[model samples]
Target: MRSSSPSPAPPVDLAKARRVAVEAAEAAGDLLRAGMARPLEIRPKGTAGDVVTELDLAAEALILRRLRAVYPGHRVIAEESGVNEGTGTAAGADAGLVWLVDPLDGTNNVAIGMPVYAVGLALCAGPVPVLGVVHDPVTRRTWSAVRGEGARGPDGAPLRLAAAARAGRADNPVLAWTQGHEVGRGDPVVLPLRTAVEARCGRLLQLWAPLVAWVMLARGDIDGIVGYRPELVDLPAGALLAKEAGAEFRALDGGPYEPSIDLPPAERGFVAARPALLERLLETTAQACRPAAAGTGSTGGTEGTGGSAGAGGSGGAAQGGRVRLTR
Candidate 1:
C-alpha cells in the first residue's frame, strides 16, 4: 500500500515507453513468427481455463493503437482491453499514465510451437513503473528499461542492471518455477528449486515469461530467478529491471508491490536468488503459496511479466546464451 506519490526514479525517459513498446513488440513478433509451425485461432479465456489467439488480438490492436496515438492521456491495463480509458476497478492512479500490456507473453508457448513467446510493455506513472519494454519478435531482441537511465539492448545496446549485494552461494542458480501453489501441501517451492538446481549442476530452462526472468537478471545471465504466480501485469517492468540490475526481489508473502487495476484474481507470487539466495528462495516460495496444496505441479506460464530473449538463462552465460524465460 505504499504510494505516497513520489516515485519518479531511475531513467524514466518515457520515450513513449520505447516507441510504443517497439512498435507493439515488432508487430507482435510478426504475428508470432508467422504463426510458427502454423495453424492457430485458439480461443478460450476463463472457463476453458483461459486462452486466446489471432495473435492476442493482433497484439492488442497494435498495442492499443500505438498507445492511443501518443499517450492520449494514457490509460490501458491490458491482457485484452480489460480497462482502456475508464470503467471500474481499474486503478493506476486513474490514468495519469498507464499501459501495462502483455499482448502475448507466452500464450501457452505461442500455442505450442514454442518459440517461447514475448511482448510486454510497462509504463506507469501513477503506480510507479516508469517505463519498460521487452520485445523478442523471435530474436529481434529489445529489452528496454528506464527508471534511472538503465536497462537497454538491441539497437540501443547498453544492458547492465547489476547491483549484486555480494552474498555469494549460487553455484548453478538459474532456477524458476510456477505450477503448484493453491495453498500448499506438496509444493514447498519445488523443494528449493529442486535443491538449487541439483546443487548447481543446473540446466533446466523453462520459459514462460516473469518478464523474461527479470531480463535474465539484468543480463548477468540468470544467477537466480524464481516465480510462483505473480501479477500487476507481472511485477513492474521486471521489478525495475531487477532493481537496476543489482537484483533481489522478494515476496513469498513478504509483500510490497501494490500496484493494482483491481488486483484480486487470487493473488500469488515469489522471486529468489541474489541476497543469500533470496532467503532460501523465500522459504521455498512460501511453501508453494500455501493452503495445503490447492492444485499441483504449479502448471506453467503467465505471471512473470515483461518479455524478450537472445541471451540469458542457466545462470551466467550471456555472450549469447539466447535467454527468454517467457515471452
Candidate 2:
C-alpha cells in the first residue's frame, strides 16, 4: 500500500521570529562592541587571511544562548561551532525550524579596527527565511525584515528599493563586491564577473563584510551587491533583507537562488541588484562566464522563484561552470 504524504509544519509566527532574531542580534552586537574596545588576540583559521579571535567565539556563544532560551528544540547552524541538533529531537519534527547565525561577519575588518562589522541572524522554516536581523554595533544601526511584513531600518522606517531608484542616480549606481579570501581562489566565476560589473557600474566597492553590504543595499546606500563562496551564517540574513527591500536576487548565470541549509558551500554566491539594473547586471555576469567562442545569447531572462538546478559537489567551483546563489 502507498503511504500518505507527511503533514505540513505549523505556520510560523513571523513577528515573534523577528523579535527573537532581533534580540539575538542586538545582544551579540553589544558583546562584539564591548569586546572590540580591548586588544584581541587574533589567530588564523583555515587560511592565512581567514582569522578568528576570542571575541568571535564569545559572541557566538552569547547568540546561541539567546536563541536556545527561546527555541531549545530548533536546529542551529553557526560559524564558529558547526551544527547543533538541539534537544536531540527527531529530525523530521525539527526539520521545519532552523537558525542561521553569523556572530562576526567581518572578523578581519574588526581586527584591524576598520569599524565595519555586524551580527546577523535568520530564522528559517525549512529553506525559506521567515525573519532576519543584522545589527552594526559601531554605528548602532539595525536592519530587519519579516517575510511578508517588509524590511525596516533602525529607526523603524519601512525600507523600499524604489527609494534609491527614484533618487535620479541610477546612472551612478554603486555595486559592492566581496573581497573575501574565498572569492578569487575558490570561485572562478567571481573575478571575471567582478571585472564586468566594475566596467558596467559607475563604481565598485570591495567589502570583506557581507552583512554590511546587504544592509547598505537595503538602506539604498548602495545599488547592488555580489558575493561568492559566502559562509552559511553570512548570507541568510542579508538575502532576506534584500528580498524584503525589493532587491532582485539571482545566480550569476541569471537563475533563481534556492536558499537552503543543505546547499553545498560551492553554491553560495549571488547577485543582488535593483530591479531595473538586475537584467543588465545578470546579462553582463553571464557574458563573463560564457566561453569566448560561444557568442552571447539571451541571458535566460527568467524571474527567479528561489529554485535552480543543483550544484555539482562541495568543491571550489560548481560543475559545468554554472553559477549558484547562497543561503
Best by lDDT: 2
Superposed by TM-score, candidate 1 places the C-alpha of residue 315 at a distance from the truth, in angstroms, of 23
Per-residue lDDT over 1-327 for candidate 2, one digit per residue giving the tens place of the 0 to 100 score? 000123224355667777877878888888889888899998876532466789888988998898788777777877777666667444446556778777887887777888878888887777667678999989878899877668898988988777446365577678887533443333445456668888988878766677888888887788888665455566678878887888887776778775444554445557788888888888887677664214323222211211111110011111112222222
Residue pairs with backbone atoms closer than 3 Å in model 2 (clashes)? 259-327
What lDDT would each prediction earn against the true structure? 0.55, 0.67
lDDT of 1 at 166: 26
For candidate 1, what is the TM-score?
A: 0.30
All candidates: TM-score: 0.30, 0.82
Q: Worst lDDT window (10 residues) for model 2? A: 308-317
Kindly report which residue stretches of model 2 are placed more than 4 angstroms away from their true locations once superposed.
1-11, 88-92, 163-168, 183-187, 292-327
Whole-structure CA lDDT of model 2: 0.67
Q: Which stretch of 10 consecutive residues in model 1 shows the poorest summed lDDT?
A: 313-322
Q: Write the per-residue lDDT of candidate 1 for residues 170-213, one digit (tens) a residue.
A: 55456554322122324344455445444443554556555666
How many angstroms is residue 142 displaced in model 2 relative to the true structure, after the best TM-score fit? 1.6
